[model samples]
Target: MMWGSSEEYKAMFVEETNFYNRIILGWFLPPMMWENLPHFFQTWLRNYIGGVFLYLVSGFLWCFVIYYWKRNLYIPKDCIPTRKAMLMQICVAMKAMPWYTLLPTFSEYVIESGGTRCFPRINDIGVPAYVGYLLIYLLIVEFGIYWAHRELHDIKPLYKYLHSIHHIYNKQNTLSPFAGLAFHPLDGILQAIPHFFALFVVPIHFTTHIALIFLEALWTANIHDCIHGKIWPIMGAGYHTIHHTTYRHNYGHYTLLMDWMFGTLRDPTVDNDEPKKVC
Candidate 1:
């Protein structure tokens, strides 16, 4: 009923499933090669290979934009990290990749439990419903990550033991695409909980959920890249770059809505005039 007749839905699901499998697997392997792979190998490769490929691609693209374009050259040169520091940040990010991989499994468990629904086919739900669910998911995730992020700073024990590792890049330049994921594993997990929780709280199509994951990576990189500018209420690189320098404000991940509501929002343009040391 949520879609259509059982038979029609199943047929649509099968067609969409094949389409995704082809597109994903084809990214790394030629279609001719992937089509001939054993069933088990195909399944395993798609599961383990697909997400990581997308993550790496997304990170690389953002980093390229920042580095090649010198996107925020206007920022004081001293705030940028040295070449060695940038390398170290990338290494730390590599260390955290395994934790990122585990996140999807958590979402999968939620989906299997009937607590969440993810339609695999676009046709299964109309475009309007798909867009509506995506908006709701974004709102839920923004609210959740905002509080989780703020608590990571506000709570003394959490800050000292876990969140402080991320605060190391308390200035600009030292941040890179990888720096976005270079958190203490606990810190990364805590922030990611909202993303998983969104799946349970709303009906998100599988494709939309994948897009969210990619967006998370890209946005994280953009924020750390320290390009000063606001995208309306959504805090951009400028907002988060200031957060790194000041360490007490601009905690929202995607938007300033929660920060504005809670009075934690700090305008980057005003605050940048007098950057403070991380206390």
Candidate 2:
């Protein structure tokens, strides 16, 4: 058995996420409120409520450190987003937060219900094989996300209805870490679908998968901050800033390899001579 028995392993997701759930369950909510709701809704709420604090805490802390204490060092003159823009970013993200979280919550339910290929322990596959599977899983996710993100632009209605919400902060003057997740609800979830897609095809560790989903919150905050890390392979804020500006190049997510492969890559070091394509 994965844990002592099927029953024990099945409860693992709840056990892992419950500390955050207790914030809702222990204080403003009673057990009765949760017991009465559908299981899917309950899990989604746990993720959504916990995610609100996670997004705000990490986003604000990054803002305080990079946008506030060291403003001149990170942001250029006139590039600092106005307070109104910051509030708009936060509001857009808050509105989409629930749907952004729902996919992973559903993935966890599928895994716990014995519907995915995910294993609960590294030892189940041994250290060597665990590392191999992890590398493969990461690559699949990177490849899948690049295409998912790019297609969101290439497709007409998808770009017009969903992706355009995020493109609002297309300039450095308008972009901030808060703009990281200021995507339309469906738009964000569609980009994140690759994470769930990896589960059925790869031997990902169950807990590790969930942790990575949460980590993306912090990461999106990084890439949208507009301060390039200048590391090759990794698609930093500089390249992402160009993506917002031109809407035609640098559609890769996480890595530049896909952009390089598909001929959409642009170097921020060079003046953007590429035509700004419109839908």
Candidate 3:
């Protein structure tokens, strides 16, 4: 099995003292406090509490950056949500918290067969192999999310009943980082299926798994933040803002690869030349 040892697996979840890793991990659990707990308790806290914390912090950071630091520089003034809509988005996200917490536990059960290799540590495999696994995992998630997201729009019943809740923020001004998870519970679950499924099909390192989860949170916020611009082929707020404006296009999560391949990719640059349309 490409997955490493139990000891190596456990090491990835343990608290670290390095400043960079500590800062990243600290966003989930306080080093001075939670790190002192027993390894079992620490690991449990990191998985459950940390997962929720990452979600909240990622949303808040994007909100803070756009609302405070960048002001109207990066994000268009028209695209900024009203305080009421922002508050409502937060309320909807809070309702999804239980689902977020349960996701990890559900994933554990799904991938737990025999000695389970879903949580390999960094040293368990060579760097090249580790990077390759991450790339594969991302491709798998992208393919899954593209079709699921596209169908969420194509299927009228699913769109009206489930996906439509997300479209409430369809226009730019109503969009926010919190709006990313403001989806109906069923809609959120469908988009997340690939993450869990990958655990069974791929030899993912536990650290990479956690990192991907964090990136998903960050990217979700980035897409909804309304900061217009393309990061090359990688979809950003510009790409997603267009999706909100024109519901029929740009359904891929992180990249336009699937959208381009499937003919769903609309040219966002044309809209960029036009005057800003704020909600």
Candidates' lDDT values, in order?
A: 0.70, 0.81, 0.71
Better of 2 and 3 by lDDT: 2
TM-score of 3: 0.80
Give the Å shift of residue 66 in candidate 2: 1.8
Tens-digit per-residue lDDT, 71-128, candidate 1: 4453544655677877777677667766665666455434433445566666667889
C-alpha RMSD of candidate 1: 4.1
Clashes of 3: 0
* Cα shift from native, residue 12, model 1 (Å): 7.6
TM-score for model 1? 0.79
Candidate closer to the true structure by TM-score (higher is better), 2 or 3? 2
Q: Give residue 100's lDDT in candidate 1 (0 to 100).
A: 64
Would you list the clashing residue pairs of candidate 1? 80-173, 81-173, 81-174
Q: Model 2: per-residue lDDT, tens digit, 145-252?
A: 888898899998999999989998877667888998899999998888889998888888877888788888888888888898999989998888888888888887
TM-scores of all predicted structures:
0.79, 0.88, 0.80
| Pairs of colliding residues, candidate 3 | none
Worst 10 residues of 1 by lDDT: 1-10
> What's the candidate order when arranged by decreasing lDDT?
2, 3, 1
